[model samples]
Target: MKTTTAFPQASRSRSGWLIAISLLLLLAMALISLGVGPVSIPLETVWQWVLQRESQESLSEFTILSSLRLPRVVASLWIGAALATAGVGFQCLFRNPLADPYVIGASSGAALGVATSVVVGGTWSVAGFNPTSMFAMMGAIATVGLVFVIGSSRRGTSSLTLLLAGVAVSSLANALVSLLMFVHDGQKTMVILNWLLGSLASSNWQTLPAVLVLSTAGMFWLWMMARQLDAYSLGDIASQSLGLDLFRLRLSVVLAASLATAAAVSTAGVIGFVGLIAPQIARLLVGTRHTLLIPMSALLGASITLIADAAARTVVAPAELPVGILTAMLGCPFFLGLLLRRPRTYSRPGRRGG
Candidate 1:
């Protein structure tokens, strides 16, 4: 009995350590990111600036930190966390390790929306959201809604059915975006293309509030569903038998995740793989308790995004690669390796043995 109790306690201790380390890593990455851009600042200086302590850095350096890098880093942190948290939710909801926030056509729909806005050449703003962001959010929500409606049955929503529906919608939306890009003028096309490739170059204090609010709400909502999601791992019938409303859970999760994805894609432009990679890595580190998994995933996601964003800014120097491209470059290899490795083993929490 003591041995049995010791094992669970040991696992908990390890998870706690991992979570603490993840938080520290995320903080370190955020600081590193703030100092990484053109005209680099020192780490100590970055820390001083963050803490509002006097520093020898010039006013221009301070301006760059405050006006530019800070917001972008903050955006990356929250957006990554949101995407990763949403990823955990979707993965549990779907019972598929490969499932991500964008698995349900949110990225494609947001891309289409942004592409449409760029083509239309609008300068409108509503409640801190530009025309592009507004359209992106609308597109994501609508696409998710469409997929849910099509995928859901009278009995309940099946993961496989929803997955198929998402794939179809995503393909259609991607096609539409491509068509728009092909038809538009070169300059506008380039704008849309850059956005589709995903860049945080545009993230600024002016536009971050809306993203923060939406993402926070979505993440918190999803976190609240942690128990339901955990119950789901017992299988759909078991979950339903436990007085969990399967339909409501599906709807709430899809909606919450869509909200977070829309906020992210609208700001960062369809960054992928953070959602897929972070959650899996988190599960590997801390095991599969949704309560721990969700927060650990958030930290890992934030750290990964910061690293990718920093690399995107500096890897080419002066000519920045889109962060999204960097993430894909990183993600694709990881994804293939995930498949080639013990995918079945990795998919389960705390049960690595075949």
Candidate 2:
């Protein structure tokens, strides 16, 4: 028989080239995003504007580039990174490829919180207490706590239980949000709708610091746990054999994921699927190794959101569509394809790969 070593070597070489090309594509997309908008600007002008060089341009163009576009781009980058990190964390914790950040009801909780803040506080509270972000964070934390409690059994926590509880809590939260909408004053309904649909339009230097801090802290924390995450992918027995404390590992992953997600939702108001889709894309590219997987997901996530945000701005011109809508429009088909490919099975170390 002819030796096949050359084929394997060529395959590895091809995969390396593919990864390098994907990184280049991500960079190109990000640059393209900065260039396209309602008032189109050349890539060179956009680059100069980004570098703070004075262009012989109208004041409006300068303001649009610096004040509006820059903030949106930054927000999209961090938000996408946060969501993707959370998605990878959750999927690993549950050992379910289908698990996402919203699988634990964080989005619905944040939505309920935002709705309450806008409807109740905006209408009833006296001047000086805008609690929208506060309520949003509280709601997300509470929902995650509730899901964890419901999911844990006398023996331990089950991923299936966690998922089911999350669905229940999310459904209940959604119902409450609908009830609030029904009773909400006509004037505030638009505000509520916009909040749920999500946007980067409101981002500014004032709001940027919190997102930067939270996302940075969360991403760093997740990166630290990447090894433990890889161990867990081999299942509980495998993790224990590898010297990991299963409960502690799971707890840390869940908390880090929840905190990152809550921060993003509180800041930007429920942008979806950046988490779900980004990690999946990363897995397809890099396999299940968390060290490479986490960073790759962050890059992919940032790229996807940047492109989607650019489309949202240009597609509707002055009106502007929400970023969440664009992500859903793109993610749903890919998600379904993943589901149809195979039913994934979990396995422990020393067992045959399922």
Candidate 3:
């Protein structure tokens, strides 16, 4: 994790205009997703439906779209955005381009927590927050904290240590999840397995608001720290000299990332790759400043998930694939391609000017 190679410099995000275009693309993708479901609705009809002025068409499609697809799509959007934003924070905190929300085992820990909750068979709520989410968040925080502790036990936590610790923790969490599934009944086993695989199937109006609150709060916190994150990219000492409380900033960023990630997993059961890939795509377009990277990542993440969800339902028709599966299919190759090409370029990190 120690090195002399300088971090790659990106053009600073000088204007917000490009980000505006990303928002527009997100809107277009949402509409397209609405029309591309199992029961396809015409683009014109969907457009009218969205506009809310009465159309001379049947209401069944609208009902299906609203009651079912709407919440599902909204869940995907929230989870995607949250995860992608989390990824940005982690990348900066760890000073590693490949760092992601799951890189520190947050997703696996959240899944394990939910699986335990299901087996425990108690539906507790705190201030209207469901126990599932509460437990998931706790697990994610605990896991990330553990990884952080172990990774930093020897020295200032290096990216290699953090990543290695994360892999170990992730493996342990998945093992525990498997153990829980095996001890349970067939019905419970199926539920656990499905949740682990990830889907937006469980999302509904009842659960949407919780995710919204978490996403809003977490993203806001991260955005507010964007400048500190940019400073961290200049290396830890330089960031500290810039009046950043490096320890507190790193802790806050990690916690924020964990909170968003846990909420997404709680709502949609560990949808993968949105966190890992979206930020990279955003960086390519909007450069590396966290202010620009965060929003752009969120938009791209939401759009990718919507498109993936659309394909998930229609690809096998009646036998729908999990959205997580689709993400893996897409992400694995993209990730490997990143590794395969210019392998050393991204890992190099050092100080840079604001």
Candidate 4:
């Protein structure tokens, strides 16, 4: 017993250090991102701006850093973390390797809500935030609830059934979105289309707090229930025998992940595959325990989002590409490669050998 306990304790300690190192790496990447772009400020200048100290840089540079760049970066960090954390929860909940917030159609639902707001006499903003964000949240929650209703029965949500339900619902949402786009004129059509592509260009200081708070709350809840999520990887019978309330635990996690994904979509416009790739990478590095997986995944997620957004903004020079496009470009190929590499592993699985 002592020997068995010692290994996990030692592994946990190692995982903690890995998280710390990853955090430092993430900070370095963020700082590098701040310095990158058309203006090409020095890293020292970026650091100086970060310290709230005056820099000798031009006023335009100052404005870009303070007003334009910082908020978008912060938003990316939060959104990445939120998406990744949701991926962890959904993966654990469904016990399916392919499960993700977007995979389950939560994002599609959110997109439909935003589309409705935009198409029906334009979107409204309160303070600085648009009505589309609120609509997206409601849409995501509704979609997730509908999925559970369709996929679950007296026994509870079946993982395979839930996946199928998500696909069916997603197709329906896309059809509705297409119908709305067709009804609108060219201008509104372009706007809706741009939104669907996903970008962080609209992020600002005023609305960042709401997304941050929602995502943080979700992460906190997942972190608080880490052990329960881990226990869930075991068969339901085993989990129940160990005194885990399968129903309540499943409900709470699904809600938390949906809320987080909604907040992210509202801010960032449906960036996909961060949730999937980040967790898989973290699990590869640190193994299966949720406590370690959650934070580690968040770090990698933020890093990946940061890099993708940097490319999105700079790759096209003055004309920016949507961050979502960049993520999809990177992730789609990686996903394909993963599938080709491990067809058998994915097909014959025991909780992904959790």
Candidate 5:
């Protein structure tokens, strides 16, 4: 019997149009998100503001748009894109449909790092990164390293082992975070809880630049490896037989994904399920080809994040809900549905009647 891969060459032809549509949809969502909040700015005004054609009478709108909403919107886009792109990288590398930063403990670890920093009471910065971000990056990398080490054996890491190890590590990290919150003062505890729940409300111009740079660099590096990921999707033996260096591919993917995840967690405080949900949806739409999948996933992720943020802001006016809570509510059901399905569900990408 001939070996087969999930990604078919035929899908490549439509990737351009798919990405174009996704970009358009993401733009629409961003525009809508900008206009939604405690004070409603009309979509028309939002568009006018975007074009720098705002009337002098709309100065208040301009202040809210430029000073408040824009940074949060931009952060949502970049952070969501980073997480979703990292999800693609992780799922490809692990050859597991369920793999993601949140599921694999990277987010928990990063959050714990941030909590630790808060407890330590630090005012430190390195290369435009505050102590929280530095610790987050380190924690993400360390947790991923631990998972790989624990999952590895004489035959190397298996998907099941990695998944199980990740769950155990995630639980451990979460517990430690809770302990820190319990031991700290009320103010520190409040800060830790806020970060844990995940909010883009605090995203401002000051920190947005660093997040943009890190996420862009990390996601770009992953995008460059799309070809390798597609090859790896063919399975370990086949990819290695094709002269693909599995070790190099794994290292590159893990590092890039971890960096992206860290950037997101540090900025948005560990939003869950975007990474898990976005790539699967993208794969269903565009097939398993990472080139198409990456961009589509990024756009979808951005749109989802924006919508969640909009709801978080407006759902309880004056008192906002954490964006993470909304994503978790949406993702939990979708994740459970995916889990209940037969294993064959993922055998063919973009095929509905599998």
Candidate 6:
């Protein structure tokens, strides 16, 4: 006798309320982020600045609004959105909530690429490209490709196998990075350390286009795969039974997600936890439905990063903390709490629909 439990009506209603509340919270956080910084701006001034409304505001105020704060805020928004959307896609692909965008070794690959560009590329210049960004993208793609090849068996890819391969690749990349650091002098060491720490200090309008392109494409691609992702949550056999082409679906997701991640990391370095935490928060608000979860997660992720960036700038006054450090500091405890919550177990074979 096969049985299945549908969500209760009350549960559905509660989910709706949670989603609404989450959206409100995101908007509030964004506004708060724009207002708080090393030099605080009045809410009215921020509003005017955002709307391009000129006021009798001082030069310092204009500098803070236009030159310093605006680019960083925008970077936080897009970067966070990219990571969160990618996280959702990755978690769905692996069928593991603990899985993150970095699980496929993209982060390590990006790091290696950055290291190579800094160490080998004289002056870190290449005709038109920023060598660091270019190398990071290349490393990310190569890492994904390697993981795919290593994880595939005669039957096709196995989640367990793919995860293990990623772990191996990540370890190798980390070792290489460490070795490079060990051999470098003080100046080189400082450059590598700062890059690894992750900062939004370098953001500008010039970097926005690439981030927008990658993020928009990735989000659209993931949304298109919403049904397939839902099917996968039911298990491999269930997805196959539903006419989903597992290999093709997985490839598309990985490609889209990896590209988005690579673009973001190339510009911002590794900003951890946006992908992992954003989706979980979205799920808590919107249940397991991918359609709502994906976009909402993107928004929430942006809000979280923007808020964290604001805190980083304000906490030290003229000195700044790495945005990545702030994210991990917040995300780690939340992750531990989730682990201790003891999630429900679904029987393997019983994953098929009623």
For every candidate structure, what is the RMSD over all alpha carbons to the true structure, in angstroms? 3.2, 5.4, 5.5, 3.1, 4.3, 4.5
lDDT of 4 by residue, 1-354 (tens): 012453547776788899999999998898889877656778877877777678464556778888888898898998999899999999998888778878778888988988888776554677566787777777888898898778776477667787788899999998999998898899878877887888998899988888999899988888788889888898799999999988789778888888889889987888978998889878878888887899998898899899999888889888899998899899889877876775264466456443
Question: Which run of 10 residues does model 1 get worst, by summed lDDT?
Answer: 1-10
- The CA lDDT of each predicted structure is 0.87, 0.80, 0.81, 0.84, 0.85, 0.81
TM-score of each: 0.92, 0.86, 0.86, 0.91, 0.88, 0.89
Distance from true position, residue 196, model 5, in Å?
A: 0.8
Worst 10 residues of 2 by lDDT: 121-130
Off by over 4 Å in 5: 1-11, 124-128, 146-165, 334-343, 347-354
On a 0 to 100 scale, what is the lDDT of residue 248 in model 5? 74
Cα distance off (Å), candidate 4, residue 113:
0.7
Global CA lDDT computed for model 5: 0.85
- Residue 139's lDDT within candidate 1 is 87
Error of 3 at 240 (Å): 1.5
Q: What is the lDDT of residue 53 in candidate 4?
A: 78
Please say which candidate is ahead in lDDT: 2 or 4. Answer: 4
Candidate 2, 251: how far from true, in Å?
1.1
Off by over 4 Å in 2: 1-24, 122-130, 153-155, 337-354
Give the winner by lDDT: 1 or 3. Answer: 1
Candidate 2 per-residue lDDT over residues 229-333, each given as its tens digit: 988888788789999987778778878998888878877787888898889888877767787788778888888888888988999897899888998898888
Model 5, span 1-354: residue lDDT tens: 122456574556577688898798788888888999999999989988989996888989999999899999999999989999999988887777778866678888887898889999789788767787778877887898887778765476666677788899999998999899888899999988888889999888888898899899989999899889989889889998999987678778877888888889987887989999999888778888777789889998888888889899999998899999999898789768866773566666675553
The deviation in Å at residue 263 for candidate 1 is: 0.6
